[model samples]
Target chain A: DTAVSQTPKYLVTQMGNDKSIKCEQNLGHDTMYWYKQDSKKFLKIMFSYNNKELIINETVPNRFSPKSPDKAHLNLHINSLELGDSAVYFCASSDSRTGFGEQYFGPGTRLTVT
Target chain B: QQQVKQSPQSLIVQKGGISIINCAYENTAFDYFPWYQQFPGKGPALLIAIRPDVSEKKEGRFTISFNKSAKQFSLHIMDSQPGDSATYFCAASKGGGSTLGRLYFGRGTQLTVWP
Candidate 1:
């Protein structure tokens, strides 16, 4: 079974379009995170949610929002998608007690803005 | 300053050779250090990790050497094979009473093992 799964392994959209990427984890972890990997391969944290409450929000644009209806899911929605926003988005989860803070990652969703 | 710095953006090694990637961190609060491996088109996967208390940790052919005073750490892969080629990232996170936090990752090093 996949520990973490993300929908739409690939996303292609036009500018000004609204899109959402869904992520779910069956590991029953209390924390979920959204990350963006740019073309240069730099992985940056965009948002983090602990038990359905937002905890960490990086200097990301307001156009991007994350919603966690429950602890097991965190979905990302982007409004008026811009070309610069085209990048691979990844969802990850980790249990607070793992000591090593080991994060399990889901297969990335490649977003392309045309 | 980049919280974490990685060296040798890329490396090439022959089969059965040794491959090494190094990283440095400036935050003393960071106590948990881990390395991740990523294949193209895939997300990064945990490879190995080490804590400040320990100078080194080894799992199979993968090893992590840490230097607390120097604020540096490195991942060494022995008997490198073509299958071992992948992008490797070294990351650090706050420990102690700190809750699970987002990790600070290095720019990553691409390893190519040629047969």
Candidate 2:
């Protein structure tokens, strides 16, 4: 079974379109996170939720929104996407009880806004 | 300020050779350091990690050397193999000992092992 899985492995949309990527983890972890990796391979955290509570939000644009309906699901929604939004978005999860936890990452969704 | 900095944007190594990548951090609060390996079309997977309390940790052919005083850490891969060719990222986080595990990653190093 895929421990951490993401839907729509590839997304291609026009500029200013709206899109969403869904993430689900079966590791029974308490914390889920969203990250963006740019063309330069710089992976940066965008948001994090612990048991459905927002814990971390980076300096991402307002167009991006993260919603965690439950401890096992975290989804990212983006509106009016810009060309610069093109990047590989990754979903990761870690057990909160583990100190210095090892994060399990999903395959990632490659988004391209033309 | 970039909290964590990694050296050598890219690296090339011959098979069976040793591969080393270094990282430095400016945040004293960062106590846990992890190195992740990523292949094309995939997310990064944790390879090895270390805590400030330990100077070195070894896992199979991978080793992490940490210097708490200098706020620096390095990843050494012994017996480099072409299968290990992937982008490697060094990351650090605060409150890791307490479970506030949000990793701040460095610009990844593209590692290519020549067979």
Candidate 3:
């Protein structure tokens, strides 16, 4: 079974439209993260949730919000999507107890704004 | 400031050759270092990782050389094969935070192995 999974592998929406990407992890990890990879292949962290508590929030725009209902799920909602929002979004999870923790990434969701 | 910087935006190596990619970080608090490999249209996967306490780590054909004093690290791929071609990323993080570990990724280096 896939450890970490994401839905809506591809998204195409008009400018100013709203969309969401859903993520789920089966590894029983307490921490989940959202990362964005731009056209330049530069990956950057956006937000992180640990056991349903928001922990890390980067300098992302207010239009982008992350919601985690529980430890197993974290979803990203983007409102008023702009052209610059085109990128691949990745969901990852890791066990917090391990000192050498490494993130397990899910197949990304590619979002395109036109 | 960019927390982590990586060199060689891309690399091409012949089969059986060794491939090397280097990275440096500005934060001394970053004690955990990891390298991730990504294939086209897929998510980046952790390949290998090292800690500041260790100078080197080897996993199969992949090796990580770390210099704690300089705050630099590198990934070395031995006997690189055509199938090993992919983008590699070096990341660092301080593991004790509430988020578990929030990583700062380097701009990926695309590696191509010529058969």
Per-residue lDDT for B8-115 in model 3, tens only?
Answer: 899999999999999999899888999999999999999999989999999999999999888899999999999999999999988775545788889989999999
- Descending-DockQ candidate ranking: 3, 2, 1
lDDT string, candidate 2, B1-115, tens digits: 7879998899999999999999999988876798999998888999989989999999999999999888889999999999999999999987643236688888989999999
In candidate 1, stretches whose alpha carbon ends up further than 4 angstroms from where it belongs are B96-100
* Model 2: pairs clashing at backbone N, Cα or C within 3 Å: none
In the range B19-102, model 1's lDDT, one tens digit per residue, is: 999999999999889999999989999999888999999999999999999999999999999999999999999853334567
Best-matching candidate per lDDT: 3
Docking class of 3: medium
Binned by DockQ into CAPRI classes (incorrect, acceptable, medium, high), candidate 1 is medium
lDDT (tens digit, per residue) of candidate 1 on A17-44 = 9999999999989889999999989999
Fraction of native Cα contacts kept in each candidate? Answer: 0.44, 0.54, 0.59
Worst 10 residues of 3 chain A by lDDT: A94-103
Model 3: pairs clashing at backbone N, Cα or C within 3 Å: none
> Which order, best to worst by lDDT?
3, 1, 2
